[model samples]
Target: MTTSTTRQPIHTSPINLTFLGTASAQPSSTRNHSALTLRLGSDAWLFDCGEATQHQIQKSAVKMGRIEKIFITHTHGDHIFGLLPLMAACLNGAGGTVDGADDPRTQVNLNDSPMEIYGPLGTRAYIRNGLIYTHTLLGRPYVVHELRFPGDPQDGDFTHLPPHRSESPNGRNIPLKTDLNDTGTWRNIYSDNVLSVSAAPILHSVPCVGYVVNEASVPGKIDPTKYIPDIKRTKTPMSVMRRLQEGEDVELSDGTVLSGPPRRPGRKIVVLGDTYDPSPVASLAQGADLLVHEATNAHLPGIDPATKETDTYESVQERAISRGHSTPQMAGKFATLIDAKKLILNHFSARYPGDDDVNEEARKIMEGIRDMASFEYDGPVLCARDLMSEDVVLQQDNR
Candidate 1:
């Protein structure tokens, strides 16, 4: 008797998302302003191209030709000021926009495609205005799809207010409520067949958004040749194996059935371009495999590590809310609230020099928060730095 064991082949494509820049409002010696490259397949999703992002890219393995989508969270100078130079240089290398895409490629070469810019309304006009003043240098076409929210930015979250607010006569400076402005309101940004993007407003002075990118499930591969009948069974040709790998389940006249293993999603990454509280982004970021939160105010090393578990540790939550960015403690709390598997806090303020300060701060747990008053969800936390690349993929267990 012949025995054949089928191993459900799990093929995983490693996705390496490199942090090109991770500063919030300003760039310091330890950190640069906002910029990130989401390596989804061969394409790259650029979030908030701040000043010097192109320079950062040049220093990394990110091929300048691979950047496809540039999603600007807001028009803030720190978030999008560097767009002009990045766009111009990319276009110039690809040729001119209106007349540039015609570049012919040799057998081994491929021409760079138009870069898609995704942002708020008037983005096209803003880029054009910048380009108009600058000399003609690039010729690559890019389309900006504005992501306009349903409501205003500065208004408090109307969805989270108690229902009794309406009953109160002439409420005391309480803001109006709306489900659209809820803490967990997530809006689907983009989707094709396999992958989709969703985003929600993060706590920021401007109309900023934190995005969640998700890829669809992929079925596992099966070995049809293993299902061959035992009566004088013959080895199937390589062509047959290829077809089976393509999900062509088949039954032979000899009564053999071939099947594949269970299917599952690739992975989930909760990447925040630049945010503070990010309470509004909870819905979109719920159950994220990884949370890349902004840790603009982690100054932990100044304090002793023993104080992390002690009652004397001061919480940075208030400072985070006031500054419109998150502290390490707040970032950890946000990650825990969203059921994230891992928390990576970066985007430090220029004030803190060297990542030792960042590591010290993020590691310093908030001793100030009393358990009775709130839920301080603390999980695994790590700080992010520019030029650092991390691997993330959705596994079946994550699903």
Candidate 2:
């Protein structure tokens, strides 16, 4: 099912995936580069910040001010060019100005909480250079956490890169850290009270990684009317209801004990970077509710010679492998392997005429895989477009 790309309605589901931009390598008339936002409760976690991502957010329902964390896949320009601008916009109160003025004298404090950024090695350098050249400073400093796989290049080991020429010597530089963990292990990168984020290295041209966002399981709804008819007739105290909602057994004055409903498993959403092979994401994305994978190209019938706009020298599969990208078929197989309930194909090539073409091709490939393996995966294969939003509904299954 597809919907308009204007705004996503408020949903009861705990997690939501909003595709800010879905183009690959470059922007097109209808599609932007790679960028998406995972809205968990009131806060937002951005996956990538490709070119014009801030503009895309402005067009969608996602609030830039709520983006507390950003995860970059690689250093490619298409994937990260818009990051600094977005940061600047966030610092400017999402209006591109501080205190409603562009003048530095009227700059107002913004971003009360420090924004955390996660990416592979060289992320620090990239952000440092962008901030330096742009002359952008935040009222509340941000932090950059660099994620690296085993044996990756190690640069200068400062905990955090200091600000470039501090104007208000009082303004603190954002803390930085190099989180180097064993390769192929899903290491906990960040966590809060409501959600936990983990990352694992994926097959990309650069030191890229995939991230999984796991929301904390919540206790199912408890109805006092069903458990205790006397309490419902007399109206139980709010405190007693709160205790039951907190998953604690409560006893009323009548000496009758009431137990809360069982706690259901939380939802899992996986966002994969550009990868030619999907094997790396298998273990990390097992049984995910939503899998956002890149589909750079489809297995088109004929190869048109290289034009000024398109690459000419290699076949679709050859180009995908050599450039560390994935085809639609590869993405479908990966989703099948991971048992993702729903698949959202993103980062489409500009060559595709429309979303229907991309969705059809991917579905055909997925169907082929199911037939070959004698298994069935009937989940939706959505072709993501800029500003498209999907609500991730958690399954109640015990599996």
Candidate 3:
């Protein structure tokens, strides 16, 4: 007689990040472009989708149907161009019922809901024009909502747009009108039971902002023995159990009182998208479990042979003003100043093939900063790879 075995599905704790397109510009055969996916339990959020971002998603661990939220940093082609393909994939690629599937969570309506998008400005028009032309709305209505920080919307479309420069006084919405109406104000972009997102104004030729997504504070796990029930031994009721777990007073059936919840481990993660060289961004990501910054070029100050003109060089600071880009050094220092737990340099320039130069130069800068920062802030520093996944945990099992 032979016995057969069934493979049980593994449960993975901690959220993960899948790098869809790490390149800063257009998608080449070797590199896709700038796109990232944040996995929060069953929900995945997209941060900037450039050309071929959907392709990258297809090649990675992310399921097109799982991503319900997309947050675009700015409306650059390298950032928002992939919205169509990603949307199509979600419409046609996922949430279909399988014959023998038995996962209990798949029976819910959220399992089939379309994506929810959030961005700076012009996002609604951009998506509507692109999707409407292609007839991309298939089974569900994928909603794209705009995020208006404290200051923005100089055009005075506050309901749909951000605030305005006229609102601040010596201020108002933003400062000038270039990128996001040149408003120098920031806001929290995304949030839920597990995580929260915040935005920061960065220097750029166009309106650009960096995002910071943080893991939310987690409540302590409760001890099952504490909720022990007698008589029928059916255990504690969910409402009373919830209140007790929250460390609040709860009344039992017999008028007995319960208090306190045992504590458990917790962690936080942050991602910094494309922006010019700025210090406040680092502070925004301070004490983060992870920091993903854009490294568009290998910055060394006048070491170029590509183009002899001023338009040829693209540093993190100058690019934000001239061509709107960021260099490796700027990214490294920003992560260092904020004292991030982990620094992940991303958004590579298409100038170098295979992204070899960016890795070498960016590593050197981070190493130098670690030596000079005058704190024992030695932690993991990674150079993100296209279509790769990063598991960001609040605490490691061994730790």
- Return the top candidate by lDDT: 2
Q: Candidate 3 lDDT, tens digit per residue, 189-270?
A: 4444445666665656555667777554454656757666531243545656666666676666666666656434345556
Error of 2 at 147 (Å): 0.3
TM-score of each: 0.72, 0.76, 0.66
What is candidate 2's lDDT per residue for 112-171, written digit by digit as tens? 346777787777668777676555655555666676556755445332656432222222
lDDT of each: 0.61, 0.69, 0.59
Off by over 4 Å in 3: 1-12, 92-114, 149-189, 220-266, 280-283, 299-321, 355-377, 396-399
lDDT of 1 by residue, 1-399 (tens): 011133132235666778888777778776677888887666678888889999999999898778867877778888888898888676653323233445341111213334666665445557755654453335445554555566534332223322210021211111213465553444445665556676766767666777787766666556444643431264544455555555556555466765545555556777775666688778767888788877666435435343334332245555566767766666667777888887776677665443553465523332222121123455555556788888776555765
RMSD of each: 12.2, 7.4, 11.6
Residue-pair clashes per candidate, as listed?
A: 8, 2, 18
**Which is the winner by lDDT between candidate 1 and candidate 3?**
1
**Lowest-lDDT window of 10 residues in candidate 2?**
1-10
Residue 54 in candidate 2 has what lDDT? Answer: 90
Clash pairs detected, candidate 1: 22-347, 96-139, 97-139, 97-140, 183-280, 266-394, 267-394, 300-361
